[model samples]
Target chain A: MKFVGVTSCPTGIAHTYMAAESLEQAAKDAGHEMIVETQGSAGSDPIPQSVIDAADAVVFAHDLPVKDAARFAGKPTIDVGVKRAISDGPGLIAQAAAAAADFKANPAKAAAAAAAAPTGGLATKVDSSASLGTQVRQWLMTGVSYMIPFVAAGGILIALGFMLATFALGKDGPVLITAYDINLPKDVAHSIMDSFNPLSLTWWAALLFRVGVAAFGFLVPALSGFIAYAIADRPGLVPGFVGGAIASTTGAGFLGGLVTGILAGLVARWISRWKVAKGVRGIMPVVVTPLLSTLIVGGLFIVVLGRPIKALMDALTNGLNGLGGGSLVILGLILGAMMGFDLGGPVNKVAYTFATTGLATVGLATDAVQYKIMAAVMAAGMVAPLALALATQLRPKLFTEPEQENGKAAWLLGASFISEGAIPFAASDPARIIPASLVGSSITGALCMAFGATSPAPHGGIWVSLLFGNIFGFLIALIVGVVVMAAIVIALKSRDHSLAAANA
Target chain B: MSLISESQVILDLDYPDRHQATRALAETLVADGRCTDLDLFLSDVRKREEQMATGLPGGIGIPHARSGGITTPSLVFGRSRNGIDWGAEDGPATLIFLIAAPDGGGDAHLAILAKLARKLMRKDFRQSLSDAATAAEVVEIVEREVVNA
Candidate 1:
């Protein structure tokens, strides 16, 4: 007997192919000819019509609705769920074959039975637990995609803004500045200062400028939440956004916003799977989910999470405002160590959040500790990918061709404070890479602290230099950290002659 | 009709390398009238393996040459019970089906390979094949599982 099958799933990743494999194997074992077409993210690749026409039976195994159902019109078709397709596809195929044989023997009875059978389609039967890595990757991918434009726009605009400011200041004749001064006439200086004054601009222009800045400030969290929503579906957006906003306002920082974004997205997704009413399905996704999620999440943040976060930020600010000599260096070391420990994982995010909040609260008040910590964290995070890339290049034999390819991309990403660029390395050998990155980052952080590095901007890499502060020390710290990491990797790899021999 | 003697050199190979494994198997089949040229058949099989890793999900690898590589349609069962590094993701491969067929023999070879893939996925069938020591025993199992289709 000949059998034809269609396999599909919603995500179109693992289950679809697994089911196809199971069914094909079953058919072969039963001494039956079979062909299976897979419908997935790559789209459908159906078995030829001729094959289907010659087949004794057809099986449709899918979670999503199968396309071109009409083609199987007179054929004995069994519609099963994706879970069944993966778990019991072979059994179903055997059953279909037996049924087909029975039908062939008693055509009139089989036709009558087929007419009486329900055609509402089968329900999915797989366990619904989302894995941790899958969840993390989903949220991270969304955040990364959304964060791209904001990072690009903000970095470019700020760079250009600094250039303009410098040019304007230069034209006005240099003042006798205390550090890194350029000579200029008094009248020119006055004109330069006046041009920079907010009041000098037209009211509308000033208002627009302020609005743009405000929007720029909020863009990161907003986009982060939206991206999380996209990953988790409609219900995730509201809570994600509200939680992000609260995180930002309460000084929980970008890390907190990220956490809230993921939490909200997951909650939204969970609610959607509650098997609610069909009549209210549309409303549940668009209206009820978002509204209820936002209220609950926003209220929680404001009442429970927000107050403690704000108090912590206030304490940190007060300490920086009243700090002595060695405190700045110590803070820098801690921040740098944290940033390097996990690259872009939770530890790194916590360090980043700390720096951003520190800068926001204390940088405006002539506090140097906040600047020191920010500089160190940013420097440490930037070093990880660059270090890994350099290590791969130095010891190419120790790594796979794919790893080498990823190394090239990592170089650019590392230089830009994109810690995620090191993910491929971590994924391939988390045990070795994570520890190595942490050590390198900590070294960089320590150097930054020792040198009293300062960066007004909370972000890192070359872009951090644009903010009003000393950049030379930050650059030195980053370079030193990356170099240290490279040396360690090379030394470790050199000792593994067996690995080299295998590659050869 | 059997094109080659069931006792031909197709089954008894214990080579270290992939090229050697193919050549040894091909030479056996050729000596038994399964094919005309061992070198040509081995080369064709090697070329196909180069195009993609033949490693299946389970510990099986089906390395087959196109019909042009053979003088006649034949199934060669080669077992490396000691385990050979077949570049499989799941490590070494224990079972191999070296299929050779006459030029333009339609999709019979593909159908056979597909059948073998399905049969190997079954725990009982795989275990039975693993336990089968003699070439005749293996042939009987394949004919029972696949030929009935």
Candidate 2:
């Protein structure tokens, strides 16, 4: 058998390379050909795609997520920590060989696992060795990750709807138009179905607004359902969605959705793992698990948890409504710092989710605190990438070849509000880049809050400026952040005495 | 220019803890003139160790650093009669390799480390190190297995 693998440890110096050697030696003794990639601080010499394609089995011994793991999707895999490979190399190799044989014996089972596995580009290793907090973050991130596109679509559509309605009715458009059931029959109009006029701005505006509302309706359920999916795969989906829908109906908002997601996922997972007869086992996931879990979770939410959660949501809403002057600036500072901290990591996602989830309650009032938060987050997010790009442009010699190239692409990415465009620059020199980012973003966040820039759209950055109120304030905040961050980065890099080498 | 030499090998390196053992190994590199500043290199090694313990499951600890204090790519071999706790889950490490690489210019020592790293995992390679009678013999083994690999 041919085996291909990757080995990485936290420090990425000693254990990573040793694990690769040990695995290689063990495979050789078993008369199997093996290729191992060692991902160390010095960097990795990645195994060829052809070698991975030819391999019957794979061994991933890493404390970190295997970079580009989806490449080996359908292969028989043995995943463990680097220490395990070093200690029991022979055992892991034997397991890999066994897994390969198992695949050949039952190809159908392997296919089923592959089909159900979340091996998309968002693949993250929920390392059993990681702390409970880390594990929970990974799970929550999976749900938030899937929930993003929904928010983007719904938020933008709604913003456009509001925009068109305002344009059509001048100022009284939304209030008057919303009172009438756009779907209901009234004389000869969209209510008349076949009499729909494409050129009628008022009619089109009302239609877009209603469709946007329909999309917003799915927001909470999707968040809860996907969170549950992260925990227990497909079996958790039914209860998760049920729990989310109940939360939405109860007016419990995102807090309720979060609770229901975890509850449903846990209950479903527990039920699926119960010891049962062979016949019972076959019906377990399909009939028993979802049924029992949904009953348990749904009852708890309605009778026990729903009221307290709704009250909490009310208190939160009131608190945000009362937030003024100083408190708002502090909140913006914290959220902005979090956004820049990890560059689209869990911290950034948490900040993003905080802003987007609040969008559910803001309802078309662009002056609401939720709208201001959305504005602040988007402004802060745009700063890092644009700053990195500006820094690279200002001093191209300070950055590496790859970073300079990334900077060129960052102009468009930053304009589009993709914070991840700065990740490459941060990854190479975190100590210098991260602090500069935090400082810049915090200032940007504070200034945006102070300026009272309100964003109607949850996303689209500068492109969705039509949905933003106080457009000049937003532009000023964004510009100030970019310049400050770029200046700080340059100052920090220039401080280092060994500036000649460039690579170092 | 060699990674490990006679001056860098200590047959009976006695120390209270891994910190002292690391300091002792780093002192040898300083004496060899491979490391320019003992404090800087030692601090760098400690910083790297703090990120993650450098202990391997077998009775081996490799403490390393890429520091401005290092003038050359150097390796020091230390054998402790009484093992020092290197924070491995299994047990204490008797064999310690302190690797110091230059801060800039190139990564010649990292290449040496990559080779030494692989060889250290083999049982025969480890057995040979423990069986070596003198510092010169141990240096010869490292040169053959790692430097010449």
Candidate number of the best TM-score:
2
Task: List residue ranges in candidate 2 displaced over 4 A.
Answer: A1-125, A176-196, A497-504, B1-136, B139-149
What level of docking quality does candidate 1 show? incorrect
Q: Which TM-score value belongs to model 2?
A: 0.67
Tens-place lDDT per residue, model 1, B39-110, is 777777776678554555456665665545576666666778566666667677777666665654544443
Q: What digit string (tens of lDDT, one per residue) describes model 2 on residues A310-401? A: 99999988898899989999998998899889888899988998898787773445488999999999999999999999999999988877
List of clashing residue pairs for candidate 2: none
| Model 1, span A1-504: residue lDDT tens | 999888866434334555777888778888998888776533345454456777888888887666555556567778888657655666888788987887789878877877676754421111233466655654564564455455445433433333343344442211211111122255444333233345432222323323333444564476447645655655676787778877877677655676677667777777777788789887987788887777777787777877766676567667766766676666666777787776776667657756654543411422257767767877888988999889888888777776787688788889878887777677656767777777788878888878777665555467546653456777778888898888877676666666767888
Q: For residue A204, what is the lDDT in candidate 1?
A: 23
Instruction: Give the poorly placed runs of model 1, Cα more than 4 Å off.
Output: A1-152, A155-212, A219-232, A246-282, A299-305, A319-325, A357-359, A362-367, A458-460, A463-468, A498-504, B1-149
**Weakest 10 consecutive residues of candidate 2 chain A by summed lDDT:** A119-128
lDDT of 2 by residue, B14-68 (tens): 8888999999888888776888888998998999889777887778898987788
DockQ for each model: 0.05, 0.30
